[model samples]
Target: MFEVERHCGPTPRRLRETDLPDLVTLSTAAGWNQIEQDWLRLIRLVPEGCFGVELDGHIVATTTAICYGRDLAWIGMVLTHPAYRRRGLARALMEHALAWLDQQGVEWIGLDATEMGEPLYRSLGFEAEESIERWAAQAPGHIAGEVLPVGFEAELDEQAYGVSRRVLLEHLAAGGSYRIRNVGYALWRPGRLAYALGPCIARTPEAAERLIRACLACRPGENWFWDLLPANVAAVELARHYGFTPRRHLVRMWRPGRAMRPRPRFRNEWIYATAGFEYG
Candidate 1:
């Protein structure tokens, strides 16, 4: 068995641009799909809110907290190197990140908890909110229909996610955007292993399909990842229509702190595709 290097206990520190390589390596070792740029975005977006632990002079654990003002926030990217498993490093970083977000006075903190991490999250008081699934398929051969870009629906988005996600959505908007007037919007961005279609908010299946086709046309024949809430039958049907199959599952978990209980839940039925696991 490998052993921790002597006198090499690294405390929680702010993740920096310099830690990008180590971050990617740690996540890859865990069979995750995050890439270098993904980790860098988190670092630059909220360096102070990103925390990591080093072992043997390399980062082996990490956790990120993103705040949408004091009203809502999210904790994600909780990962640790395989060699360091069960040593409490991931737990420590989580506790640290949660404490930090708490200090920020964020009313609600949520995360998409993987099966392995659910028990720990339960101990920390994060109750199940809903089921999120990762669906995937090869890009459709032909664009199904005409889709229009009607610009961002910030007000609609606010109702969908319960908080304005314009900050995050704006950054990913460059990837691609599909929208329908008075209906919904969907975005497509490149991912480490495939293109991600998500944060999709649609009023109807037709609207969602319109947005989905626009994105698939942008990158034909490439792998696509769609994370959606199964509660919305339309979202699930749309995925199947596009040949997307359920690949992974996660529970949207939430913990309220320094605020009232029964935290306000987001409109999951409206979220056809998530921005990313790290994001939601």
Candidate 2:
């Protein structure tokens, strides 16, 4: 397994399947939404990229990197058990992910950083790109409709995400519903505590609202979550109009001069909501 030297205690190592239980404990303690399956998906997608630090034979810190076909890589799940803080475990795990990604020839590395984590990432050469907010609301009544096939949705996602994430999209859409129109689309899936809406793309604010409204109407009266870029004023307004409140904030940061291409030809205006901070 991957291992790193530490001055104080046991070194961090590659995360294994057996670590799931302790990993869940770490996430739960941090108030994160990741379930076991979420961890499984990341491991299955990039086995060598998941790492954890242990103390007293119990996992205490974790981090993950998921590369999207050498185009870009997303770093997430950075968590440190409260009792294990101030030991630099989080930074060590992050450095491991970065070194691993670089070895794999990854060009762009991106992540959603919390206020508490921003300084570390900035020190590692990541610059803030945009602000993201978590919006929550009560689900609306059911609205009947069939989600379009994955092939159809991927085209729209490609335009908005600026990269091909067919694998990730397929996983997200497996049990989700999508509201699709010629101009936009919105997708939502069940979460541990609420329904999550995201990857919403559209040609205009009105189109985005239509798709979001339809998705919310599908599961009326239940709690819902939506993560959107604050730069999209219309999207923020749409959420506010729907009684959704911003509950959390994160800054999207990326390493400079690392994009494989100058930048993907995508329309930020069409991105009303991102798939999720972890996956993006």
Best by TM-score: 1
Tens digits of per-residue lDDT, candidate 2, 1-280, equal 3233455544668888889899888888988766777777777767888889877778889988888767688999888888877678888889888988988888888899999789999999999988888989885445443444332267777777677877777776654545454566676776666788887888889777767776777687889888988888888898898888999999989984354465454476788888778887
lDDT of 1 by residue, 1-280 (tens): 4464446534799999998889989888877767787787788778889999877889888999999877788888998887888877877788888888888888888899999889889988999988889999998676555757635566678888777777777776766787776678888777778888877888777777878887888888889999988998888998998899999999989887775845655776677888888888
Against the unseen true structure, what C-alpha lDDT does each candidate score?
0.82, 0.78
Backbone clashes in each candidate structure, one number apiece? 1, 3
Task: For model 2, state the Cα shift of residue 96 in Å.
Answer: 0.5
Query: TM-score of every model?
Result: 0.92, 0.87
Off by over 4 Å in 2: 1-10, 141-152, 179-183, 257-261
